[model samples]
Target: MTTLKEPVLTKRIPTHPWGDPTDRKVVSYKQYVKTDGYKGLKNALAMEPSDVVDLVKAAEVRGRGGAGFPAGMKWSFLPPEDGGRRYLAINSDESEPGTFKDRLLIDFDPHIIIEGIAICMHACRLDTAYFYIRGEYHHQREVFEAAIKEAYENKIFGKGSKLGQINGRDPDLFLHRGAGAYVCGEETALLESLEGKRGWPRIKPPFPAVAGAFGRPTIINNVETLAICTPILERGEDGPKWFQSMGTQRPEGAPPHVPASFGPKLFGVSGHVNRPGVYEEELGITLKDLIEGLCQGMLNGKKYKSAIPGGISTGVLGPDEYDVRLDFDITKYDTLGLGTAGVIVMDEDTCMVGVARNIAHFFGHESCGQCTPCREGTNWMSKMLSRIEAGDGTTRDLDLLLEIAGSMGALPSGRGATICGLADGANWAVRTIVNKFWDEFEAKVSKQRFVSLSVVGS
Candidate 1:
């Protein structure tokens, strides 16, 4: 077992990690305009489009989304030759459980995202874009829509607007809200939802870049992925450089600022802690720092036994892995992908079986039902977990789940982009839970059976 030094608690959160003042008296409309918020867009106008791409690549400002694909690489995927109307879709559907960081960006700093997306569209030569928000965030939707209107009224985004005047060209950006569906958080599923479809994922090889919404080349980026553009362009290569300056300098420990493969992950800490909010720290911060120091430890000095680090899909971590740094390379230390970067902590009272079952149930509902493997696999995993929690599970059932999950794991892909990562994510969660907490689950079943016999005798 890896022993970690105790954590240090702090009151202040880093500015980039959703640290904006929420309870303010001033109108957000006036506040953003006064702050010179659109300065990045102004700077983007002076440079050539490809120069924007080169600047992002040079600064190494990778995506904040779970996949951590390079932002520059994704932009470069836009057609070199003007094939047709390319689209940029902002993935604001924050449905991933525990991942609440993006909600803060939309609720507090909507204009910043707007400016970032506009600049991104300019760089990609995209004429139209969409801010695909989750439907349940009605208040966030209202705030975001109002900000979009404010930007247009101030001539920041529409054709012949101040943004156009600065960029020397005009483009269109629109806001569209999605009915709450966790599957829609997937890029391809999001594209399906945007096109007035039922939101089922499509197979890959013909990635969205090749055949996307309305059969046009498209780019689906996360909300934070777009927000980083503000600093990227504002500093004009210096912006992202300043961001890269913060956090640990080690290449091995998590991907510092931006790894060659993965980027800085925006993680949020919640559950049984003093400061139960969010932070945009580097990928390498210890889990102990995240839950104990940053989140203020378990509430009322309670003992924390485990935590679901990363979205519901990343699997749970016990005290043994507490010292492990938060990063994309979660594959090390028995962790899966650090998805969506939402850390849900569990105190000593939390039931490991119940937690795993709850997560399995969540995926069961969110499966897009397009591919048979995901459609059937998620349901089977959910049922297996339910049976185990209810004491109806056998040793064979546990083995059965691993088999199903193994079959559902990413196939040896000849093509790159698959429908969505939903199936693979579901498999990871089930496999991690079953592998790590097998003894706990088996013990639960035994205890429940004994209680049943005792009740019958009584």
Candidate 2:
């Protein structure tokens, strides 16, 4: 991978507020109070509800989930409060392959998420919120549940609690567990699951903003997005500026006022790297820096092959493309994508065909089976890739794989075919691997054919 000229590293501001390097214990309520844990909540409660919304908008906080939607804009989309129920659903279902930042946040800093929920509830005039955690995260769920208990016990919630009463109403927060399904990570699908229905994504028009969670107006955010609220509220206007300053500037000719993919990002780096773990870094840090600088380069000193910059759903970037900035806007061009910032690296010795097959298998199994293109495409592609990997593929299989991937709504076709992004993800993995590593796939086929000819002569 090519390296870029290093930008001057700015003073590293603490992004993980509740994280203590010296100790790994969960932050107790008393310890949290000492560090001004609820300061954002207190400040939010003092502000007019609309002003709180404006404050978040001015800060320009983008959703930390793969979509990168603006947090404040999503809140503003809610219909005017009608003296009825509105909801804030925090998506803790971190099921994206190669992603684990949310799990860490919930385990180490549960109180931060809670405080963020309180602040957002005040901003949106929401009196009820749900913390939808994945069922597999039993330990994280216990940590968060204990924190919730502590908050309520300390009068942070319940009747007559100052933190409970925001905007003249006592807000209620519920921690709901999700059955382990990748589809529930989608906000609308999550609502369906929350409402006691099967976890299938709803079609657009009346987006979750207009009607969600039992047919009421709703706003949903990922765990990291909500956790970020604490720091943003704590610093007020300065928070957004600090965040905006951290990332690379938006390229010219882009939308005139679109914010850069600003703020600190937790990159869940895995696969063939010296340090296969999550590392927090400023957004727009080059792939070269992330791998060479943070991860100490490829494991056992192996040369780089390719990488999946986001989760498995994003297309692969070869070593040559590593110079590209890891920003959402920049990645939108070409075959590149920045989904969830989960960097899965591959070394020179890795088999691209096997990798593609594995990713295809995952999406195939995880598909909700609602959309025809995704439901059928993923399974077909997986089967074909497996055949290719196992030396049973004909020469025609390569083109067939490409054809199936494009039909499944890979880029240029855009996101219209599938009910959700899962299909696109499967397409991306196959398309990129075949296109970028054609030599490897072709070599496998040629070797198999040569072996067959030798056997026939014998």
Candidate 3:
């Protein structure tokens, strides 16, 4: 089994295979400082902020928030510090089902992320940061809040802090609870929710880097994304090269600018795996190795049926695709981009139609109803799946399911822009399931009273 030379982000937090699970516990501020926790921040303080940004860019730290965008480039996107109150929005609203990696960090190693937040704010000159955690994280809210208090106590923020003033303001971080809407997980929608408005996506080009969070320059990053900055900076000059050495290298002939899936990622494996839990592994680890090695094979020795490469949003990997690598390049297998890397494994006894049905229903309910294609398309897919799962579907229902999913206005070929990625996720998810399990869906539909039906005029 492949393993990192040693744990980086999961160093303090115990994860499977690498460390004994029973040894896990919350690391307090005192414990954190003693273990060289804030050393990364100290390293940053000794260097110019632009140099830090350049260092992270050199490391090619990809956003661990599923999108996998480079953190350094994102930091550079900010308009020059004009003595304005630039903002940082840490997306801790990890509401996506099967995605629990962020929660694990908040539950135990909150200080690492706190340190990361400080480094990012310092580097980007973002004076204020809002940690937008999902409301469902009731206990986690308290845990993280207490951690932030620890940082304040240690002068991580507030007046007289180690960071001092940047862009005419003392660096500060605040915790903002979400209203438990899934759509608010989107960057623009989260910004809107933070503004005390409905959680709906905003039009882009004013992309958060330019104007966000109360209409100022803003930067949004996921919890894991920010947490990783700690290690990169801690290593100082050697950090970037050290990071690139672990994960799969750039494709043989790919351009230098094309981002490689570098660094370790926290994959929350759930569903039918025997050892269903989060594990930290370098990018490009094969799904087969993950399931067989870290996950300890399927539960009860059942065969693997399917698995979601990341969250339900990224779509499923068929049994034949077990060897597919888990990384940003996962889309080459036809699923959506590797999302949060929150994998959901299904066993042989599991029903594929029901899987698609549950996923469609979730998206349908969670959709904010702002975009017509996503709203109508997702709801239709849900109803059709329910019918198919119940054996009340016709041959035409299967075709229409694919058609509606494909036409969901998520991309250029569809109706129009989906505002946020809800439609894209929903479409790719259902479409991948149907395409991969065509035989299963067809058999279920064949049991119906009608084999074929003409479209009814609307």
Best by TM-score: 3
Off by over 4 Å in 1: 1-27, 81-83, 163-169, 248-265, 411-418, 447-458
lDDT of each: 0.71, 0.79, 0.89
Order of quality (lDDT)? 3, 2, 1
Candidate 3 segments whose C-alpha is farther than 4 A from its true place: 413-416, 449-458
Query: What is candidate 1's lDDT per residue for 1-458, written digit by digit as tens?
Result: 11212110111222422334444222365776576667788889788888988877666655666776778778887666453677889999888888898887776678778888878887877767888999999998888888888877787677676545322346677888899888888788888899898888777768887777788888888888887777668777576566565443434554445454323445677777777776656666788877766565688888877777788777778667777777665656666666777888888787788887888788889887877777877887788788888888766666677777766644332022235677777777777777877888778666443333322112
Question: TM-scores of all models?
Answer: 0.87, 0.91, 0.97
TM-score of 1: 0.87
Q: Ten residues in a row with the worst lDDT in model 2?
A: 5-14
Instruction: Tell me the lDDT of candidate 3.
Output: 0.89
lDDT by residue for model 3 over 175-278, one digit each (tens)?
A: 99997899998899999999999998998879899999999999999999889889988999998998898888777798878798889889899999888888
Against the true structure, whose lDDT is highest?
3
**How well is each residue in 369-401 modelled by candidate 2, as lDDT tens digits?**
998988988898888889889988766778777
| 10 residues in a row with least lDDT, candidate 1 | 2-11
